[model samples]
Target: MTDVAIIDYGMGNLRSVAKAIEHVAEGRAVTVTADPAVVRAAGRVVFPGQGAMPDCMRELDARGLRRAVLDAAHEKPFLGICIGQQMLFAHSAEGDVPGLGILPGEVVRFDDARMVAADGSRLKVPHMGWNEVWQAGPHPLWEGIEDGARFYFVHSYYVAPQEAGLTAAHTDYGVRFTSAVARANIFAAQFHPEKSAAAGLRLLSNFIRWAP
Candidate 1:
């Protein structure tokens, strides 16, 4: 049974992510839960988030899912989306906050100097809407998706993994930033797959069937 647990720490778009997973789950069970037991027992885990880093971390701790998340990441196929991806790093510049330290890196703000497009148009902070992602290397989750496919994004800060080899995909905003990362059993995306349409769905579907 492909029992997948979407960790509900009170910040992510839980329902949307659950629905997407359910769409591709086939016979797998999908549940949005904050219970650590449920998270620990699931075959796969998805950590999705939107909003402030401190708030996300607070809720994660409040719900007592931090350790459960770490445990799950270590033992099974784990996916993190948006700020869910940022939190995996060592820290964040958003609120000068500390993250899970699962990955060796810090989350930093997009540089203020280059928030302008090449065509001389001003760009927004959230970096909302569609952008193309360049695959850095091969991985199971990227299987049916093209090398440069657009995905939905909504965030101001981005991850800076200490080691470059961990990066799975790259995207150009004001500056180039890490859009996705994959290493061993854990994979994460700085963009929101539930809102990313086809390419997003392909990634989610791959995550569902992924044995890694």
Candidate 2:
């Protein structure tokens, strides 16, 4: 059976992600590794991250897994979550840091002026808790998931791909932003699937069975 590898770059809740994957992984091996070799060897890769973009990038390079990550992203079925999704872009306004450049886009923060609900209430930054996600188009990762499902999210920054077609799904905070992206063998989401209850589990299960 093809094993699933969750890249441990020392950010985010790796254990929660690991446990969640293990729950839906069936008999497939789920290995959380900091080693580049293990990442390259795995059949599928889950790139997950949290915290600031600068720190995330620094730690990734510090561990010498940058090349391995890029390779796996290009060569295998890949899933990116939270900061993992942000890091895939070419740049981020968080620390004005450059990303993997795997996708042509930039990560931007929610505007303070626009952080208002329909009721004229102030919305907080980091955009925590559950929000509805609207599918941009059909995707394998979205299988078994409803078009507008609520997923757990906790981030201030969101991705804006130059190519609108790259967006797999979007969510509204202060504005409509790309909440998920899909291209080739890769699919990424700004939300935390592990924390998203039944809908989250369904998405992970779809990823496990997804060929691409």
Candidate 3:
């Protein structure tokens, strides 16, 4: 079987994600591909992306990866990171752009007004740093990871699912937001697990072995 396929649509540097998966995939064949066929044929799919929502959507379609992504999300174990996670929703406030609608939700930016720490310090918009992630519940992908482990984040926007049950984990910066989501065979994270160090590696390893 094609063990893992990391979708490449030219959004961001996908090499880190590829290397991280390679570290955990054992001898599993990991392919970084832009081909729709490879993505559809893979046993597991990791959709990692960054940048603005509108551009991401356009690039996805332009590269002819739209249908393949949707298919993998429905048929196999799927993992989405950063904008990859946001694109799974119905819409995004980033540019009033529509998404794949695989999940019922919208991606919204962190409020500028609420960008303050408890001591009244200014919090940055990108939220670029390590933040504590509170696990919403147990899942196979979270195996060997603590509930409040810190993960690296580098984005200004976060997703708001229509259903609360879809939240796999949450984190607080300006306000609490869905940092990770899971339903059926899909699990997505707003944080960049590839850059999150040991805890991140553990999560990736779990995903490699996750059968659901």
Candidate 4:
């Protein structure tokens, strides 16, 4: 059986993500781990993270699993969620922290403009709620999920990949931002699947069944 490793780097909503993955794993071996050896040996890797960039990076490095994550990203089907996805970029405006640089881009904060809807009410920062995600490209991870599907989001910042083609899906707040991305063996999302309900579950299912 192919083993799925949900990296426990001490950040992310590990329990929720692990439970969600386990719920859909069917017969696969799913492990919530911080061990480099376990991560290296897994057939697939799920990288989920929350909280600030600096702390997340600190924990990942403190645990000495940075190299393991990089290796997994290169050698296996890797799924990066939220801060896990943000950390894949070259840099982040959040605390000016540097990222893994696996994907060419920088993470940026939503500008401090006083955004207002046509109804004239102030739009909130940390964009927490269900928002529509428009597909920017096609990938196996998006299977069965329709374009313009609503996914749950909770963040004050978003990724801005240098390569426009890297964006797999986008969402609009005051501005349009990349909500999901894909390349080679990596597919990542800025939303929390465990909190996203049905469409989120479907996306997780697709990830488990994804061959590439």
Candidate 5:
């Protein structure tokens, strides 16, 4: 069985993510871990979050798992979900907080000037509900997923990576923003695959089979 560690950084929906991985990977062993040592030993690490970027970074620093996760991302398969993906950047405009600096970019809040709501309600800040993803690269992590397939999203802020190649998929809210990113062994998604139904499951299964 493949050993997958879901980092418990006191932010993400760890239980839901673990359960989703189990459902997709079949008999694979999944553990919700907060220990850096345990995370270091895992074959793959899934960092999932759904809170402020700065608070998430603080939790990671306090637990001393930042280095372990970054090293794992370099040497092993790593997946970041929601704010977990945003934290991979250098900083976030959400709370004037510095991120893990693993990836080059910054998380910024959706601008009303650039966004337009169909209902015309000043464009909601937290972009909640299903949004279509337009695939960019030919990364194995997105195998079997169709372009423009809708995925579950619930985020107020979005990542804007400095490197364009890192963006694997994009979604349109008010403007087009990164929905997924992949660079070598590192992979991340702004959408919630656990709650995205069949398309999301297929995406996770692809990640399970992806080779770093």
Candidate 6:
């Protein structure tokens, strides 16, 4: 069985993600660890988070998980979720803070001024709730997932990759933005798969089956 490690850096929804992975893998070994040694030994890594960009970066740095994660991404399969995905970029407008710089891009907030609201009120910053994901690209990470499938999204900022072909999926708020991304062995989703229901489970399963 494949051993998967969900990096526990004190900010992610770690338990739910681990449970969801267990549900999909059945008998596979899934462990949530804050230790860099365990993360390095795992066959796969899932970087999950539900917090601010700046705080996430600080926690990873303070805990020394940043280098471990980057090393794993280069050699093994790495899955990042929510704020986890945002950290893969170069920087974020949220705190004007630098990211892990795994992928060449920056995270930016959704501008409500450009959107036409029904009540004439500005669209909320944190775009919570279910939204349809329009998948693009042919990466193994999205192999079984279909286009227009709804995924649970809860974020104010979205990733804009330097390479357009790296965009695996997109979602619309005030404007369309990249919701999923894949480059080589690294994969990430702006939406929360653990909170996305069946479609989300299928995505997780696909990740489990994906071989680096």
Each prediction's TM-score versus the true structure: 0.97, 0.98, 0.99, 0.96, 0.95, 0.94
lDDT of 4 by residue, 93-193 (tens): 99899999999999999876755656777788888999999998678888889899999999998999999989999998888889999999999999988
What's model 6's lDDT at 48?
89
Query: How many clashes in candidate 1?
Result: 0
Locate the minimum summed-lDDT window of 10 residues in model 6.
114-123
lDDT ranking, high to low: 3, 2, 1, 4, 6, 5
- Per TM-score, what order, best first? 3, 2, 1, 4, 5, 6
Model 5 TM-score relative to the real fold: 0.95
Candidate maximizing TM-score: 3
Candidate 1 accuracy as lDDT: 0.92
Task: Write model 3 residue lDDT over 150-175, tens digit each, in one string.
Answer: 99999999999999999999999979
Report lDDT (CA) for all predictions.
0.92, 0.93, 0.95, 0.91, 0.87, 0.88
How high a TM-score does candidate 1 get?
0.97
lDDT of 3: 0.95
| Deviation (Å) of 108 in candidate 1 | 0.7
Question: Which consecutive 10 residues in model 4 have the weakest lDDT in total?
Answer: 112-121
Best by lDDT: 3
- State in Å the error of residue 96, model 1: 0.7
Task: Give the runs in model 4 whose Cα sits over 4 Å from its true position.
Answer: none
lDDT of 6 by residue, 1-212 (tens): 33999998889668889899999987889999998999999989999898888899999999989889989888898999999899988999988999988899989988777764556667777898998899886777666777798999888889999999879888877788999999889889999999889989988998898886
**Candidate number that wins on TM-score, 3 or 5:** 3
Flag the better candidate by TM-score, 2 or 6: 2
